[model samples]
Target: MKTARAAWRRLEPVHGMIYFVPEARRRYADLGLRGRAGYFASRSAAFGRASAELVISTFYNFNPDFVRQAVDGAWDAASPHQVLDARYAAVGEALRRAGIHELPNLNEVLALTRRAAEAACEHPQGRPLFAAHAALPWPDDPVLQLWHAQTLLREFRGDGHVACLLSEGVGGLEALVLHAATGEVPVGLLKSSRAWPEEEWADTEERLRERGLLDGDSLSSDGVLLRQHIEDRTDLLTLPAYGVLGDADCERLAELASPFGRAVVEAGLLKLG
Candidate 1:
């Protein structure tokens, strides 16, 4: 489990930088996907004309109305195949700019991450988003392939995370409120980014209070314990994919990928939500 987490913690930036970069927005706009529409569209492109409800279910933490608005007419504006092409192009541009191609052990990191990603493909029973992505043909370029690999790992962990959240009876907004209590992200950012209205956000918090998961703005002792359990379970769930790497290779994956992740951050490619 530690290995699973360490591997994800390092590779996440490699996959996550797509959301914050200007390149994504510009490319999505070129495809007529405006605002957050690009995010929902490009990420869910593998679904090929996925409905908003499907996006909401897979994405999990976002507001249903906001997700609907994003996915509405998205496929009409751009086909899933086109969105898929555009997103790869955008990532390529970003990675080239960030000097990812110039990094040492680039091939080595790619090899490891790809191996882990393939392992994820084996057990897709309830992991919808990951299963959708895992079906896509691999990109030709090694760098793009590396990005795709990390993307798989991220989605694999994410799908498991959503399941864990559901098992804990944590809805999207309630999960966000609990996340805010831990201070991993600011309350304002989490609420606004997910498009939860202030009233709805407060209402969610009030409900958490009633359930004794929250004490005012902070997580109560019980809430903290539950949150820890959720995280532990999420990490454990990822082991089936990462366990194939064994502990040493998992740690090595992190060490080799650290510089690449740092390059993205140093290049200022990453943005806070």
Candidate 2:
């Protein structure tokens, strides 16, 4: 299970970096998408004319009105096919800019990652985002293919995560509050990015406190337990995808993927702070 998490973490930047990469936004802008609309459009375009309501559900944690503003008529700017094209083009440009293509073991890493990613596509029962993406034709370029694989795996895990959170009674806002409390990401960044109002954020915190899941700005003991349980269940759900690769191969994948992931971060393509 730890191998599953570690492997995914090592490969995450390959896909995630594209969001912050300038090339991606530039292509989106070419298609008339501006501001956060590019983000909402580029990510959800895989859903072919997806309604804002659908994005609100799948994107979970973002303010619904904010989502509506971002995704409303997004397809009018560019068809889903065009949006997906621009997305992969960004992956290529950004990775090339980062000199990721120069790595000695790029092919080896992508091959292993793709195997697990394809295996994940086998069970898309409740993973809507993953299912939508898995249906797309595979990119001929190995670089784009690698990025596509990580995208599928992450979304697969994400869909399962939403299920776990809902089962644990953590609504999107509540989940964001708890995540903020963990100190992994600043509350200001989350609140600003998600467009959650200060009043709502505070109210969510207060409600969490009332439920004994929060103490001040952090998680209470019960909250800690619940968070752990959610993550554990999420890991368990994502495990079967990696299971096809077995523990040893997954470890090798992590080892091979780690340097590239770190290289992406070091290249300043993905500024987390």
Q: Model 2, 2: alpha-carbon shift in Å?
A: 0.5
* Residue lDDT tens for model 1, 1-273: 887797789778888899989999999999999999999999999988999999999999899999988888898899999999999999999989999999999999999889989999999999999999999999999989999999999999999999999998999889999999998888878878899888998999999999999999999999999999999999999998888999999999978888998999998889753
The sequence of per-residue lDDT tens digits that candidate 2 reaches over residues 194-229 is: 999899999999999999999999899999999999
The Cα error of candidate 1 at residue 88, in Å, is 0.2
List the global CA lDDT of all models.
0.92, 0.89
Model 1 residue 20 lDDT score: 88
Cα deviation at 143, candidate 2, in Å, is: 0.8
Model 2 stretches with alpha carbons more than 4 Å out: none
TM-scores, each model vs. reference? 0.98, 0.98
